[model samples]
Target: MVERVDEQDRVLAVVGRDEAVRRGWLHRIAVTVCRDREGRILVQRRSEHLARFPGHYEVASGGAVAVGESYEEAASRELAEELGVQAPVRFVVKFLNRNGLSPHWLAVHEAVLPGDPNPDPDKMMWHGWLSESELLRSMEENLFTPDSRDTLSHYFAAAERPSGQP
Candidate 1:
């Protein structure tokens, strides 16, 4: 049984429909943050060995929020683990509904790195910087996770404006 915690971080007994569900504890949340330099946003190609979205492009960093960890903590950990770098993360948005998978609450963040993103081969196969136009075009031609597309759209909209606009 997975322990559920309240906003105050106190452990609470699982209850109601949440208790009846057989799926593993739904406590994990993942956040994906995409950042750009000079109109190009960093993107990572998931290793072909990935269980889902193999060989597909996705935001620079993302992973499961560990038990008792906050959304920002998970996002920062993922960024460091996947890219070997660290930067201040700014919350952009959150996505909570996905079908056919364990439910996850995602807190999207944005951050600008000092240089190119170097993907860790152990986690991702490749990385690159693509303009919003190019990313959107790719989405039109093939399949990406709905989460990716939604997050990309938000990033694109933000990038369209001048610095400090948001």
Candidate 2:
């Protein structure tokens, strides 16, 4: 078993070894899904040096929430660390893991920005605008993080519905 840690670095719960085998204890991660005025989502290519998910496209910016930090704080920190820009961010979704790949609760956010994105080469190597349709296709093709695909699907579905409708 593994102990899940909260934002304050406190142990929240003990999870089974099998559960940990897939994703381990639950952790919080911040994900930023920025959209341009054209309604295209920003995707990034992970650095080749990344230990995991190397050379794959992913959310605009993301990272694990630090101990003693809020989701917003983690989001902003990741953006600045990975994208080198500042913008307003709003909470859009919270994705809970059901597959046991990782005991992570994703805090997804949306950030609107002007002009093109300049990715930090240290963490990311490429950036591009992908429409929702294209993103779904990529997800089907296994081009993104497993957790990201789930969150994006939920976000896309919510966006397609009328306001205040679930």
Candidate 3:
């Protein structure tokens, strides 16, 4: 089950993930951007068997936030589940992504991987690391998941703002 949320992001109910998707209800998704010591971001191609954005490149590893789970918890879980890494993730930003394939309140987080990733074959087919500039250049090919693309832009904007400025 997923936690359904209202516009202000308060919990409305805990409903089936399918039901929330079918009804176009707002929910929570937590994605984590894993960076190496040199500041290279991990990039992954979703497995083709996946239902949404199959075979598309994504900047983060994440999924629907489970009922009763906090975004930080979900982000950490996803980072471990998808990339086989256990790392502490810090929340970076949260906002409503009403235009994505699965509209939801997205919580973006960042983590520094302790070691190289061992991606799950069922979730990711290919994974690599790229600098921010390289990722931006690759996005020009238009092969990335739409939501990840949007998240990248938001992440960049957030990083540009002064500390404590929100």
Which is the leading candidate under lDDT? 3
Best TM-score among the predictions, by candidate number: 3
For residue 77, give model 1's deviation from the true position in Å. 0.6
Question: Candidate 2 lDDT (Cα, whole model)?
Answer: 0.72
Q: Comparing candidate 1 with candidate 3, which one achieves the higher lDDT?
A: 3
lDDT by residue for model 3 (1-166), tens: 9999999999999999888888899999999988999999999998999988889999988989999999999999998898999999999899899766667999999999987999999989999899999998988875898898778878878878999988
Candidate 2 runs further than 4 Å off: 1-23, 98-101, 160-166
For each of the candidates, the C-alpha root-mean-square deviation to the true structure, in angstroms, is 5.0, 4.6, 1.0
Q: Per-residue lDDT for 17-123 in model 2, tens only?
A: 45544656676667788999998998888888976677777754877776566788888888877888788888776666543256677778888877776678877
Q: Could you tell me how far off, in angstroms, the CA of residue 32 lies in candidate 1 after the best superposition? A: 3.4
Rank by lDDT, highest first.
3, 2, 1
Q: Estimate each model's TM-score.
A: 0.74, 0.79, 0.96
| Model 1 spans > 4 angstroms off | 1-25, 154-166
